[model samples]
Target: MTDLHRLSIREITEGLSQAKFSSRELTEHYLKRIATLDGRVQSFVTVTPEQALAQADAADAALKSGTAGILTGVPIAHKDIFCTSGIKTTAGSKMLENFISPYDATVVAKGKVAGLVTLGKVNMDEFAMGSTSESSYFGATKNPWALDHVPGGSSGGSAAAVAADLAPFATGTDTGGSIRQPASFCGLTGLKPTYGRVSRFGMIAYASSLDQGGPMARSAEDCAYLMNVMAGHDAKDSTSIEKEADDYVANLNATAVKGLRIGIPKQYFNVAGLDAEVKARVEESLKKLQEMGATLVEIDLNMTESYVPTYYLIAPAEASSNLSRYDGVRYGYRCENPVDLTDLYKRSRSEGFGAEVQRRILIGTYALSAGYYDAYYVKAQKVRRLIQQDFLKAFESVDVIAAPSAPTTAYKIGASLDPVEMYLGDIYTIAVNLAGLPAINAPVGFDQDNLPVGLQLIGNYWSESQLLSVVHQYQQATDWHTQRAAIAEEKA
Candidate 1:
């Protein structure tokens, strides 16, 4: 039989329905792929083979009983940030290294209800702080295209897993550029839905206001399937949107790109450090979209350069507040033999959290400090509103905005030693989160290093269905989404 790992969600569901192969067989195929190839990519921190097979068995029974959901029996993995009941849900931090969640994250519970088999928890940045996956207490997830290069963080593990075909698709949380950046580096289609479109309860908070969970997969259609199960109103999560769940799959292949007004922010292309080749690839994709009848219009977003600073300030401020619970007094890592309460607090946090996480916490604490709150945090919020206003005005004349997902392709694992340079990796994607809009990063082409480049499509709030429709049309016209990394090819 053809390599089952390569088949998309649609194919897998159809195959199961036709009795061509049981869900158990499909699950086993992916489990085998993970066993053989995950070592090279280091994409997973944990692999629940037993749980996966059991879930597969249940999915098969559901299929036989004719009670299957669209994603029933389709295997997928969750980023470690989301709490998985009975599974260790470390957010790639030493603090939660052994914290097994008592309840499933709303996203996890919903996916399970849809019968999507859980593979395991994928790795991520410690508290989702870093721009590259390197900050994980579990070593950085390597890019499948090149073992030495970094996979974009903080959803790097999910991106690598899907890119290597270890899982058909995986959950990813975008705080700043977490999901989209890694997807760009790993050659996957990643969507960061508008804030609160997907519930945040049980998904470990990075910057509570900015964090959003979405899908990372080979095609937009797969994301649509996952979104159908993921998006909904969750009473448990106050931030969850109360709107009715969308039929993303039915509207995915929208008629065509005709009359789609795609806005290109002049500031994005003129950014100081954007790589020439990256610019070329993004422009080429735009040209292709134009050929498909979409019109490209140049627009100005004056707040473009402020995204990095504004996001860094606001995200860290929220993170400082959210992560305070990890002190030695409660759950998570506790210091042994503490001489005093203050010592216990200091040492446990110092020892448990990674360097990057601590750095952000410090920055956040300082930003939210009594003397500086108005100067830093409050001002950042104002700038954020200005950024949102910019998008609102742009969307008045355009349907979506287009840009390169990242400034360049994946860099060498430790090449960006300077924190400033590392933060700049998110220059292109941070704005979407700051504005609380939906954006997608779709694989466009390869760089000279054979690393994939992605073209980002940013849509107005609650426009995920429209964004997926546009991406589906683009993927149908191009073969970039079909290309696989050499490691995956070799294994196949």
Candidate 2:
């Protein structure tokens, strides 16, 4: 049971069943690590030691009675974006800083049902709005690989915690690459299920259409185990498709990418700002897959340039609508001594939301404003369809599209890039969300800076199982997935 922090969920569950360690012991191990290391990483918004231990005790009782399920007694940290009953559900914003959810989100509820012990709530970009997690009102999450660098966001806290071994695996949400980009920066595997593959009932709305909850973990197989618990239709979420999810871990080990048609978008490498080392790592990964008998086919996605603009327009428009409820009148933050209703609304939102969130709200409000809806929002929707059609057409010739997860690896924290520059970092990933497709971000290799570079695999709708299978095969062939940050390797 040495190096308990380094074990995957599979290993932890097996050890628990074999009586190698009690769930409380493992829970305390992670809580201890969080106490020691999280000050340096700043990954969690709230660390629930009391409730976590209580849950661990319950899991131990279940194990003794042979009532434990696959995820029983496993410790997991959740991105603060997911609503947890009684636990603070801050989407890394001051707006919800004091708000506590009265019920568990579908994802959180499922983990609780499976006997998973809650470690705490990790940090994120406010309203899932930024790339560096710097926008969090709680504070920025530093990368465990290098403290000066960002962990990527708005799931940066989730990525940082897992990278630092504060938790085995954590949940992350992908709203235009929040999960995948952070996993890419932190050197882990993250999956964004097909649009409706996972329920959004309790996930706070950033963009109802594009925001999706997913798993961020060390390897694809680990993600598969989580997917088994996380993915499924929920009657509570109208957007959640009425589809039965496949047993993600069932065919994981035996799955192969032989004869898999991997699409290479012609525009993937043509980005002016894409780093050369990042490009080299992705290309090398593709070559390795080629040697594994997978065929590479060049495909055109001419709509690549429109992804950023269209997504910005659409996500903000929806965000403006979703966030309107956060005024001073209802739950969340409120300004004191407001003179009137107008002042209350204006001051509360202005003071509560971070600068990035404010910027998006303004942009969204303007896009949906009278007389401008069709010119901007409507046309963006049209472009979104074009983007979706591009992928649908590519799927006709290829099984999955492969590209660099981000244009660059983790940048130094507080680099202070402009909003547009930050938005461009997601250029390779936003298109998948616009098309409502499943994608995986897996660590392929390290860049010149020694930061991890990810190779993103884009698959057709409901192709999560196939994507995980391909990544699992890749992990088997390479040791990159096994690499841990130096902080994780440091002895307790």
Candidate 3:
């Protein structure tokens, strides 16, 4: 059982099946790691050792009785946005800090049926509205690659936990690159399935149209395994796709890179802000894919410049609507004293929400206001349709689109005080969400700072199987996915 923390999800399952170690043993190892390392990493908002052990014991018994699922006995962390019954699902905001969910999210429930154990709730941007983990009401999650640098936000804790070996693989929600960006910064594989491909029931909303849940793991193979359990439609989710779920694991092994056409967006490579080293790594990854028999076709994303503006307007407008339920009269945080109902609602939100969340709410409210709605909100939706059309047209000529996951490697947590700069970092990622297409971020190579760089693979809608297969093939040819952060290996 030595170095058990370093094993992949597949390896963990194999060892558990062979009785090499008990589920309790595996669970304890991770809990111990969290207790030992999380002080600096600060990834988990709440660690459920007792509940996790209980699940692990159940899994061990199932294994003995030949009733275990493929990932039975495996431990996974959930981003705090996903509701876990009786657990405090913070969504990294103080407004819901004490709000205990009465039910599990569809994703969590599915994982339970698959025999996966829950380790804890991980920190995230407040209401999943920020691009950096620093906005969490619980506090920021530090990157294991470099403690001062952020892991990436919203789903940053999930990425950091996996990257730091605090958990095997964790569930993360992607809204405009929350999962993929952090996965890129942390050197992990993070997938964002097409909109409706995964159930969002019980997962707190940021932007109803843009948010999607997926897995963040050590490699695409691990993601594929998790996706099998996570991708099915749920009757509870109105947004869930009604189609049958694909066998992601089978597709990962069956699909080959040869003859696959990967689109190279000229706009992505020509960006003035793209870091040279990060660009180099992206190019190197594409070259490797080409060597594996994939064709690299130069293409244009005509709506590239419109992505950021359209996303900011649409996402915030939806966020305003989704977050309005958190009034002082509701279940969340309320003001200590209020002279009137207006005072109650105003003070409660002002005190509960973080600065960034408040900023977005204001922007969203104004965009949705009667006088400006048509000019701002309506236009953004139109631009959003164009963005989706851009992807659809590109796919007509290429099977996948290749681009840099982030403009640069993970920077210091507080290095950028400018919100515009932060928004620009997501330039290459926001379009996929607008298009409702599946995409993944795979560690390609390291930049000069020794921080990891990610190569983003954008797939057509409902093409999770093919998207994952391509990353898996690339992973099989390289060691980037297998590389571990040094901080995780340090002795207590």
Candidate 4:
């Protein structure tokens, strides 16, 4: 029998509605799975069993009263960066290890209002730096599919938890492929909505322009359902788009791929270091899309190669500014001995941040320094606009662009000793964040090692419904999303 914990959110909801299971039973099923598997996976930084059960009970009451919302009673986890009231909100950093938010982020607050049970905060890259979860001060998250491999990050924990059935689905943020890369590595579906599509009122910022939250799940439909609840305008966040969110799942049945122009950027395919197996799988995926009646068009995104340099400059420049608030004087970690205020700032930050984080902060500080601002930071922002223009030009001819989510599948933990090599893993994904466009990563096929591979689908701004529709149709024709890791099953 399939474990209830392994079921999708839609399946769980149906089971509850039919009285086949109760909310408490479903919540317990996941909590038990976390207990059994998370010790090895290290996917969760905190697991709120008490709060989850309490919320589950209330969900049951709401169901009895016929007042439950779409996500009511669904047990889900949040990326540690999304602050949760009273729950330890560590951005996988020792600096704020004990810091608890007095209130929830707009996303968490909205999820609570929608009646989604909180499973607790999953681990992430410290301060949301690094492509792999290895930068986490808490420790790296193991990919459930391959114990030696890493679950791609900074949303590694959220992706691994869902893939391992520790949570039905979870929330994640993408500031340069954090959500999509991990989702690809874990064989889960992840969506990064357009900039300003989701409120960032309480999400720990890495780069304000690039950061945005979205959903990760076993299927695109589930992602759509979760996105429906998490997306909306928030008065608290000035960047939040003040528009009504449509029912994203309502159009999943519209599988009309006819006349849908799918752009394949020649630059992505020509990028060096792409694995042969991954390339084959991506080509096969394109063939499948063609078979589904979508028209394939070769397109050029000339600025693609500039993505890495542009991102390294822009993200860290913003990160240095955003992370400046972690001084011990405020809410987070503090140094014990204080000779002066300067010592407090230096010691607190030095003691708090991980190696990769400090590197970026230094890079950012240098870029934003008075002497270098016009040469590096300003120039990078200009290149960012050019990259955005590249996508805009492509979208003028195509409805969506499809490519490999990562150059390859999950890499063994500590495989890339050089930070530059690690940054290259996200080469295909960072462009979307740089452009502030919505993107989705969906399972394509397994590689030679039998590990899953993902295909990235980039959509025009606010075209999430269209993107989900494309993935939903592809999923209906393929069983890739239905596959699970043998290790996760064994642990479950």
Candidate 5:
């Protein structure tokens, strides 16, 4: 039998049910892989080897007693942004470097109750601010595929970990294409669930309205498996929807694309910076969907041009407010020199945050300041509403919207220096978040450089199952999702 590292959560669960493999053995395999390869990838911030083994033992006992859940004994990784009780939960920022949460985030708590073993905490951009993992305070996470290139951010570590087989799957928070972009670059399937679909009780807030947590894995079916555990309601999160949770994996075999309306937004195709190869690959994916009985429709999302600027304004504005809790007096980092309270606040923040974080804080402060509120913040909110309205109208006529997840594939480290240029990479994905819609990124093909390209699928609010079904159908017909990074395969 193949090692547990090559099997999906579903496969591992089935094997565990039949007593073919002990949960402890599966957990040990992954822990050993992380210890061997993670040094080069730096995907994890904290590896909970002891906790994972303990949970695996408990899961093994449960299976022996005929008491096991769907995800029982599966090894998974959590993004550092999600808080875990008694575990160091750093949002990849110096501000919360040593902060330990007293309670688990709703997602973590739910995964634990479902009997899943947590591998560790994956790294991310500081406060989930950048498009590349380079913004991490700990260190930049090297792309497992090409060490010189970056696995996209702020969920770069999550994507890289799953792509590299460091973990079976990982959880990630997407504010503006964080999960999808990284998944695309890493050749994995990632879903940014509809806003408010998953509880955010202990997810360090990046942008209150845009931040969302979801699953990233080697395939769409694996993503669905993890989503089944992560998606649900929690009274702790005010924004959590009260709708009954559905089994996401139940519909993965539904390949009935007949009569499915797939909208091709013209604005996404015409973006100035989009690479020709990416466009060609997405078009090929569209052709494949059409062959599967999907009908492609041309649609216009006229407000697309303003997505980047509007997102920059709204996300940072909310981020500034959310990050204000990190003063020296609180849980995280404290400055040594402080003659008075004012000096304490200034020095603490000045030394704690990175350049990009500070820039956003300043921009957010300026935008929300007196006199500028109506001009900047209010206008951005209005634009956000318009983006949502556009999606609503489009969905009335189409089942899904498709586009390139990112303008290109994994870029070289430090390829994008200007913050604006980095933000523009998420143009196609941020709008879906702003509209509170579910979106997934699935590998479609490779570019001229052999880097993987991803196709973005956007579904209406609460339509994650539908999106997952479509992606699973596509993966069944294509080999892109199964294609591993050369370095990863070599290491395996």
Candidate 6:
């Protein structure tokens, strides 16, 4: 039999429907793998064996009764940021370390209804602030490719789990490259849907305007399956779009890149510190796409120069406003022996939040302050619009824009102590989030270290189906996504 843990969602579902194996057997296989390997990866914050086994049993029954969905009996992990009923949802912060959600986040609930079993809640950057997952209060999630290297931020845990085959796929949130950067770092396919394409209800707030939840998996086809279950309008979330969800998988193999106009953002190639080899790999990918019947066009997107600063300012400002609910009076962590209301607020926040989260909060508060609001926050909003306009103009003649997901591959843990250096790692991905467009990270090649290098495809708003199809076509022609880390081979 094939390695149950390594099979894709489509394969797993087909096997279950055919009675090749029970959902209990598949779920237990993943559970045992997680118990054995997650210690080394540090991917999961909580492992719910009891909950998972119960759900797997139900899935087995459903499969036997001929009532199964594509994801029935499949196991996946959720980023700790998403609220899960009766499960600890930490957001990788001490502030919510003890908090148990009474209701599942819309995404989690939806996945449960789809017959997908939750393996566990994975780790993330504390409050989703840092580009590296090291900022988590629970401790950093190590890159599965290289244990000494850092997994990309916020959604690192989910990325690590999928890359290591601890679970078939996982859910991740992309506020500022949280999904794509980690996917790039971990050698996985990840998608950040258009803002409001997926409900943000019960997702711990980071930057309300930029925060979005999406899927991380081994291949574009798997991600498309997960997206079908995850995307839709929900009245519970005010930010949720009212449009009907489309069948993301139906167009997977039906579309081709022939005559597809692929735009190359000139600014992306010439970024100050982009690795030469990484640039070469991106160019090679473009050439591959062109050979596959796509045309490449070099386009100028000058507003990209201002994306990093604009995003830092705007995201923090929104984060400042959204995270204000975690005060002492609320359900999160509270300081003991507070002398007064002021003391409680000050001590609770000071003690609960990590350095990175505190740093962003202070920066956000300052940006939104009376004296700096116009100079920083308001001006940043204007620049954000300019960036969006730049993309709009570029898309007029092109079907999609392509760029390197990150300037380089995964770096050693603690190698980037300077905040600016760490933040700059996401230079290519932040702009898409600022513009609230859909983007995907697909492995294009490997660096000198043999670490994965990914190229990003950015699409206009609500174009997730097109983006996934493009990625699927590219994967069909390349073997980059099929390469797994030595850890998987070592375990086998």
- Write down the RMSD of all candidates, one decimal each: 1.0, 0.8, 0.8, 1.1, 1.1, 1.0
Task: Summarize candidate 1's per-residue lDDT along 259-342 as a digit string, tens digits.
Answer: 899999999999888999999999999999999999999999999889989988999999999999999896999989999999
Tens-digit lDDT track for model 2 on 260-287? 8999998989999999999999999999
lDDT of 5 at 377: 95
lDDT of 4 by residue, 126-149 (tens): 988877799898889999998789
Off by over 4 Å in 6: none
Clash pairs, model 3 backbone: none
lDDT for position 79 in model 5: 97
> Local error of candidate 2 at 272, Å?
0.7
Off by over 4 Å in 4: none
Q: What is the lDDT of residue 39 in candidate 5?
A: 87
- Quote the positional error of residue 165 for candidate 1 in Å: 0.5
In the range 42-79, model 3's lDDT, one tens digit per residue, is: 99999999999999999999999999999999999999
Clashing pairs in 6: none
Candidate 4 lDDT (Cα, 0 to 1):
0.90
Cα displacement (angstroms), candidate 2, residue 188, comes to 0.3
For model 3, the superposed segments whose C-alpha errors exceed 4 Å read: none
Q: Model 6, range 333-412, lDDT digits (tens) per residue?
A: 99999999999999999999898888888999999999999999999999999999999999998999999999988889
Query: Going through the candidates in order, what is the number of backbone clashes in each?
Result: 0, 0, 0, 0, 0, 0
- Which residue runs does candidate 5 get wrong by more than 4 Å? none
lDDT of 5: 0.90
lDDT string for model 5 (114-209, tens) is: 999999999999999988899999999988888888999999999989888889999999988999999999989999999989988899998998
